[model samples]
Target: MSSTALRRSLLAASAVLVTAGVWLAAGTASAGTLTGTLYRDTDTPVARWLAANPGDSRAAQISSRIASQPATRWLSNFNVGTIESEVAGYVGAATRAGQVPALTVYGIPNRDCGGASAGGAPDLATYQTWVNGIARGLAGRTTLIMLEPDSIALQTCLSAGEITARDQALATATRTLKAAGAKVYLDGGHSAWNAAAEQARRLANAGVADGDGFYTNASNFQSTANESAFGRSVLSALSGRGINGKRQVIDTSRNGGAAGDWCGDDNTDRRIGRYPTLDTGDANIDAYLWIKPPGEADGCAYPAGSFQPSLAASLATGAANPPTTTPPATPPTTPPTTPPTTPPTTPPTNPPTGACGATYATSSSWQGGFQGQITVKAGTGAVNGWAVSWTLASGQSINQVWGGVLSVSGSTVTVRNAAWNGSLQPGATAEFGFIANGPAGTSSLSCSA
Candidate 1:
C-alpha cells in the first residue's frame, strides 16, 4: 500500500502516542515507525446491549463512551464452513473504512493453559486448517494479527514436547499470516510477568524474529508507562539475540486507574486507559490497543467474555474516590511517621502555546540526545487541521515523533495533524513529541491551521 493510505489507516490505530502518559520520562522509541488506524466494530456486545436496553439510565453515557470505542475481535472459534466468509466480510468492512483490523488468534490448543479461556483446534493439523481459512479471508488485505494472548507467556502447563509443538505451530501460523500481508505480534504478557531476558528467549523460540514484533499487557492493568518501559526492555533483549528493529503494541483498555488489579468486578477499580491510536511517540511501541474489550467479564466477575452492563457502567463512572485523609473515627496511633530527610524537587513544565504558534520544551536530556515536546493550540477560529514547523539547529535532528505525522526537508522539520487529531475547536490544544539526536536546540516555531 501507499504511504498515504497507510497513514490514513493508522490515524486511530493505537493509543494517542506521546509514549508516556505525561511525557515525564525519556522513551526508547526508534525512527521509521509503523502507523495505521484500528478497526472499530459497530457490533460490539456493548452495542447489542444498548440497542436492546435503551431505557436503562446508564445507557446514554455508556453509548457515548464505551460503545463508540474501537476494540479487538477474537477469532477463537473453528467453524470450517462459514469462517472464511465471516472474516472476509469483516476484512471488507475495514477496507471500506480504511482502518487496520486487529484480530486476536486465540485458539491455540490448551489456550490459557486450560484456564478460563481453554480450547482450540483438536490438534496441529486442524489448527493449521483453521489458520488457512483466516488467511484466505484476509485476502491479502493489510491487517494486524495479535497471534495469541498468553500463548507465549503462559507455557508452563505444556510438557517439553507440547512446548515444542506449540512453538512450531505459532511459528508456522506467523509465517502463514504474514504471507497474507498481516502484521503479526506474538504475545509478551505484561511488565509484571516474565523477566525481559526470559521473555526474549521464549519469543525467539516462537519465531518473533520473523514477525513484526510482540505485544504486551494483554488484558492486564499495568500502567502504560510501565508497559512501555518493559516493552523496550524486551525489545533490547530480543535485539541481543539478533532480533532487530522489532516494535511493540500495548493493551490500554481497562487500565485507566493505572493500577494492576486483574479482574472485572466492581471492587477492582479500573477504567479505559487510552483511545486506540498509532501516534505513540515511543519509537519502539507500535500503538496502544484495546485488546480485551472493556465491559467483557474476566471470568472472575461473570462468565468469561460475556458483556456485563453494570461492569461497563462502573468502568465509565470510575471508582468513587474520596480525597486522601485520615478518618477522625479511626486514626491509627501505633507507629510514628517519619518524613523524608531531603525535599522533593519540582519538575519542569511545558510552555503554553498561543494561537497558531507553538513552543517546544525539553523534558529531559542525556549525553547526546534529548526528549522534547511541542504544545500546539488552535487560534480564535476553529480549524480542521494544523501544522508546526521549525528549523533544525546544527547537529540536531529528530529521530522519532508521535501525536503527529512528521515531514522534513533538509534542515526544516514539519509536523501536521494526524488523521484523528487534526480537527480542533477554537482554543483547543494538542501536543506532539519527539526524541532528537544531538543536544536539544532552540528555534522559533511557526504554526498554521
Candidate 2:
C-alpha cells in the first residue's frame, strides 16, 4: 500500500479502537504499586560534566547538589541496534540495587515537532517494533515509563487523520509497556499549556485508562504546588469520564518556585526542587521527580543537550539562599551572680576566639574514591555566610560536592555556603560533604572557616 493509503487505513482502524471500548476495559494500576526508592545512577550528564570540568566556577556546587539525587534517564533513540540491550542493562541493574528506574520513551513518529529533539521512528510499524524492543528490555521488571513528553499535548500540530494515527500509536505503546510490568504515565503537559479538562481528554484519547496515570511538567518549570493542583484537576476530569483510580507525578527538578523565561539562556532563578518522595500525602500524586536533569541546556545557553555548569549552579543556589537572621530566642542576659564566699580563684583562661571553626570527617571509602564531610560552627556571634578552605595532602581531588559552592586550586579546596545553608546563628552549625578520588586512607585535611 502507498504510505498515504496505509495511514488512512490506520486512522480508520484507530477510530474503531477508540469507539469499540477495548482500551476502556483494561485494568487500572496505581502509581502506589511502585515500591522502594528511586535510583541515582553513578554516571549522569552532570557527573560526567563535573569530571571533565573540575575547574568550572560552579562545578563543585552543581555536582554536590545534583549527583546524589535521582533523575530520569531518557531512551529516545530507536535507531540504535543495541537499544534493547541497553534498556535491559539499565533496568536490570536498577532492580538488583533495590531502586526504581525511570525511563522516558520518546520515539514516537514526528517527535518534538521537528524541533531540538526532533527524531523518531519514521512510521507506526517501526515505532511499534521499537516499543516492543523496549518492552522486551524491561524483562518483566518493575519500571517507571514516561511514555512521551509532547505526543498528546501537541496534537493540535497534526491534522485530524494524523492525530488519529498518533493516538493509536500511543495507545499501543501504553498497552505494550504496561503488559511488561512497567508503570506508564502519559504526558499531561504543564499546567500552563492546556486546560485540565482538555489535557485529560487528550490523555483519554491516548489510552490512559490502560495505564497507571499521567504526568505534568515533564520538561517544563511549573511549580510543584501548581502542578499538583493541575494533576488533580486532570485526574478529576478523567474520573468524570469513568476513568478512576488514576494517579500522577510532577517534574520538580528545576521548578524552584520561579518560572523564569522558558527560552532564556541566562535564567538564574532555576533552583532544585524537593527530592523524590513517594509519600506525597495526596493519594493521587505519586512523586516529584527530576524528569529533566538540571544543567542540561534547554536549547539555549549551550547546545540543546549540552551541560551548562552555570545553569546547574543556579539551580543549586537560586531559591535555596535565605537571608541570615539571628538565632530565634536568644538567651537573655541575667544579673551577675554574687561572688561565692570562697576566695576568688585565678580567673580561668578564656577559650580561643575565632570567627568560625570546622571539623572534617571521612564518611565512607571505596577503592579509588571516598566521601567526606565538614561541619562549620559559628563562634561568638551570628554569621551571615561562611567559606571553609582545606588542603588535601594525599593528592585527593574532589569530583563532586554537595551543600556548598566549591572551587579547587592545585591541592587546596575551598567551599562557600550555598544560598540555602548559609546564615548560622551563634553556636549554630552547618555541614557539607563531597566525593573525591584518592587512596583509601586518611589524609592531612585542615579546615578554617
Give one digit per residue, the lDDT tens place, for model 2 in 303-404: 344466777777888445312221211111442122111111122233115767776765545455555656677777778888888777676777656567
Residue 414's lDDT in candidate 2: 88
Model 1, TM vs. native: 0.64
- Predict model 1's lDDT versus the native: 0.68
Deviation in angstroms for 42 in model 1? 0.6
| lDDT per model vs. reference | 0.68, 0.65
| Alpha-carbon TM-score of each model against the true structure | 0.64, 0.63
Candidate RMSDs in Å, in order, are 23.8, 19.9
Error of 2 at 449 (Å): 53
Which has the greatest TM-score?
1
**Candidate 2: count of backbone clashes, pairs at least 3 residues apart or interchain:** 6
How many clashing pairs per prediction, in order? 13, 6
